[model samples]
Target: MKSEDIQIRDPFVLPIPEEGKYYLFGSTDRNIWGPGTGFDAYVSADLAEWAGPFPVFRPPADFFADTNFWAPEVYARGGRYYMFATFRRKDNDLLGTAVLAADQPLGPFLPHSGGPVTPESWSSLDGSLFEDEAGEPWMAFCHEWQQIGDGEVCAVRLGADLREATGEPVTLFRASEAPWATPYVSPRYPDTANYVTDGPYLFRGDSGALYMLWASFIDNTYALGVARSASGGIAGPWHHQPEALYRNDGGHGMVFRAFDGRLLLTIHAPNRTPDERPLFLEIEERDGRIALAGRTSE
Candidate 1:
């Protein structure tokens, strides 16, 4: 199926240049807000034409989480492919990011990290893996706005095996920190003004500058925004750009270098269930800042 024909949320792409293919993964459940089955993936040589809904992950019968499976991002490390995803616990109504492992990009990824890597008490999601200058693994995730009035993007150092967090989570920034972010006025809490921060993906520029691609609201509309790290590192005095990269009811994006050496980005559009689809676009970096180059594959 083509990208337009597929329905997905929080879309993530893993490009294996050596295999000449790109594998796409995301929140694939029929109803992401409710119960979740597992996750699926699609493959493509060119970004437009895709191949399969390969079952990359099917939770075991004894799996800890049974709902809210979202944003599965795969990283090839130590000759193995590891998946960092969010799942909700059955016993308690809480969400956290867990680490799953597989032998290949598309595989029967099994629970490798025992269970949720983030703190069990916190409501977290959208775990993105980042390697620091010394090659230490870290998980960048969000402290849900639903839990805290001001949603926060936080990071925790992961064990080298990617199974557990070795340190306390450091709050990188709150959604309110970005000038472009607006308070999410939920009908459930009309008296409260809460800001949201989700999908913290890191990118390194040519000049060794570090930036983050994250999502929040702009005028009550979902949008994608960029922020730069003043210290050229993950743990930063991160500064937000004055404007959004894409603002039109679409967000939760990641950046990648296409096989042809072109910089590209992928995000789910419209931010509505059953209608959201992966959108690939060309992007350019100028002096460590990212701007929308334009849409590519539909």
Candidate 2:
């Protein structure tokens, strides 16, 4: 199937240099708010065409989470692969991120963290793995706006094995900190308007600057924004970009380099249920910031 034909959200692309292929993963279950089946990934030599909706993860019969499986990000480390994703249980409204592991990029990934690594009480999602200069692993995730009036992007220290959180989570920044992020008011709670923060992915620029790609609403439309770490680390005093990197009613983006060495940004477009499709845009880093070049050619 072509990438345009595949319906996915919170798009994540993992480039396997060894196999000369890219594996795409995201929120694939049709009923995202209800019970989730699992995660499916697509493989492609180029970004345009894909093959197989390979099942990378399937919850065991005794799984704790019965709904809301979202944002599966695959990271290769030390000859093994780890998947950071979000899941929630019907018994409790709280949502959190968990770690899953497998031997291959596309896999029957099994739970590695025992359960969600994020705090049991705090609502969170979109856990992304990053290793610092000292080679210590960290999980960057969103503290959802649903619980707090303002959503936040935070990081927690991960154990060497990447199965557990070793330290308390530190707030990197809030969604309202970005000039472009707008508040989303729930109709059910007319008096309470919340600023949303979602999908936090860290990228180190060629110039050695650390940037975070995160999602929120801008002018009532889903948008993607960039934040720079002033301290040049994940545990940063972050500076938000005045404008959004994308504001076309699409978001939850991540960056990856293609096999050809071109920098590409992938996001699910239209921001509507079932109709959403992964869109890849060519991007360039200039002045230690990110700028969209345009959509990749067919």
What is the per-residue lDDT of model 1 for residues 13-65, given as tens digits with 9 covering 90 to 100? 99998899999999998789988889999999998999989999998999998
TM-score per candidate, chains pooled = 0.97, 0.97
The whole-model lDDT of each prediction reads 0.90, 0.89
**Span of ten consecutive residues with least summed lDDT in model 1:** 289-298
Q: How much is 163 displaced in model 1, in angstroms? A: 0.9
Instruction: Single out the weakest 10-residue window by summed lDDT for candidate 2.
Output: 289-298
Question: Among these predicted structures, which one has the highest TM-score?
Answer: 1
How big is the positional error of residue 166 in model 1, measured in Å on the Cα after superposition? 0.4
Candidate 2, 1-298: lDDT as tens digits: 9988998999999998889999999999986777899999999998889998999999998887978899999999999999999999555778989999999888889999978899988998999999999999999999988888899999999999987899999999888889988888667666877899999999987788999999999767889999999999998899987889989999899999988878888999988888999999888778767888742111
